[model samples]
Target: MTQQHGKKIMIVTAPANGKRFCGETNYYEQLLTAVANSGGKGYVFPLDKNPMDRKGFYWDAPNRRWVAAFCPIPDIVYNRYPFKIRENKLACKRFFQWLDDQHIPCFNTAFFDKLTIATLLKNDAVLSAHAPLTEQLRSLEQLRRRLKKYPVVFLKDIHGAQGRGIWKVVRKGKSYQLHSQRKVFPSLTFPALSCLLQPVIKQRTLLIQQGIRSLKTADGVYDFRVLMMKEKKHWQCIGTGIRLAAHGGFTTHVKYGGKAASTNAALLRPPQAVVAFIGRHVGRLLDASYPHIREFSMDMVMDRNRQLWIVDINSKPMSFDENIIQQKRIRKLVNIFLKQGV
Candidate 1:
């Protein structure tokens, strides 16, 4: 559990203030403290700065503020920048390329495409049963065909997150009704599928997925958010929590009025052991395919028939809970950082 002394770890994330890294402030504070306690130095490296220059701001522990300094190429760079910034910016691409050129190890280097992951999982013999029916929405005709087979269908932006740009479509008599999460139009009734979806599909590539009949209580539909982190050479489950969607909400993202609590086995029809096993297997599969990934998050659910399904995979997972950080797994993660130095 020992780390190489004075090994530097730089956490790349979105700017919290105009000057300091504060997006996940509390979690970063705890992580920096954990790194210090483990004989390494942790710094908040902002994404806005030029990676090629090898100079950025670091948190000043004594002054309790950020100070600009000439940062050495970190032993490890943990990329936690928001998806939008990472996806759309030219500088981010250059920064990551710079990291590659420098041979610096970075985990969760980029975001995973929804359709690509789904297709890969569907093709895997062992994991195929756990994957939902997913297809890239290329045209209105494709959506129409899928709608005929499934009662409720979801059209999601391939790059969207936090429940943004997701639509729920339901059949209503001879027409169809669309319900959206973020758009100003709450509900729209369309006479034909093509008429409704042409405008949406024109905007961006969408993923058409058959909605799983979610397990629900009187409160709301619930699912699990399982976090897996690399422990030395192997992956380990660091945290599992139940997320209940807000009433009338289709997604369990916290930004959409969802709430999280410690996992309750009674809440699921299957034994918690089965769920954990599937989670571990999925994590291993993902890590094997994407070697640079040190941690990731999976969104999973159990249907009424007690079947498990993996709804989503996030390469850039959210910050870990303090309890998870304090566990023995953090030491293993730090050790990997010291050894890998990618």
Candidate 2:
């Protein structure tokens, strides 16, 4: 692959030292290294900076405005801002929409905005084929009815992320308890359960879904995080990784005391069909998500019978080390900008 001499890639991300810091290493640092090694200039725009502050073609940091680079309207603009959907949500939505309206070549369009993802899940075909079977129920009676049919069900906030607001409910004897319901791993005291649920309901969009029994590992329950990316005309599996919950854990969210391991580690392997099935549907889901959405992560699980289920689809997931396995994918994304003839 020959280097394109003058194309530049611009990155827009949340500030590293902000109070509400996103709890992960910034992938922009890695991207900067990649761009430098590839013989291209990478421009990073921090969210803290003022859009009104500007200078010549380059962003004038001193003035705090966007600068028109001596290149085309940024060969590519990557939106990697940190946003907790449950907190500071209004601001997040506004910023993302503003970027979409810019009409520059970008990824993860407003197509999967907070409202749209919720609405699309209501469609039977979309629900049955891609999303885990889920429903938003408000009262104890409605929840009890659903609990009887499914051994374990998870209560989640529609806009929640990083596993901050998830509760697993199950029935025990005559009374119900909120515990780590998947495979009866452990229990949380009833009072603690109520505390977790109270704020989630206040958020006004609470959902419950049948829990997929997770694959057990020595460390804890775990699931696969597959990296799906689009390069030119093809959908490629750039890399895959595993997130393992600490011992007796129910949710394997990295932000919630979980750890990462390679996808092929001892406890992470699933059947070939399971992997292939996810790749197929996830590709379709991304295709339907947006004609221009390029990359995202899919949380997947393999059931006892080897059937695969998509636990969640993340539009802008943590991307710390994914580019290592397939540096070509990063190169391809960079190439997209270079081809703009900027």
| Per-model TM against the reference | 0.88, 0.75
**Candidate 2 residue spans exceeding 4 A from truth:** 1-3, 16-26, 54-73, 84-103, 110-130, 179-199, 262-264, 272-274, 320-329, 340-342
RMSD of each: 3.1, 5.8
Per-candidate Cα lDDT values, in order, are: 0.73, 0.59
Error of 1 at 181 (Å): 1.2
Worst 10 residues of 2 by lDDT: 52-61
For residues 164-219, write the lDDT of model 1, one tens digit per residue.
77888876455576767654232345545566668889988889888899789787
Cα shift from native, residue 18, model 2 (Å): 5.7
TM value for model 2: 0.75
List the candidate 1 regions with Cα displacement exceeding 4 Å.
1-3, 16-19, 61-64, 84-89, 182-196, 262-266, 320-332, 339-342
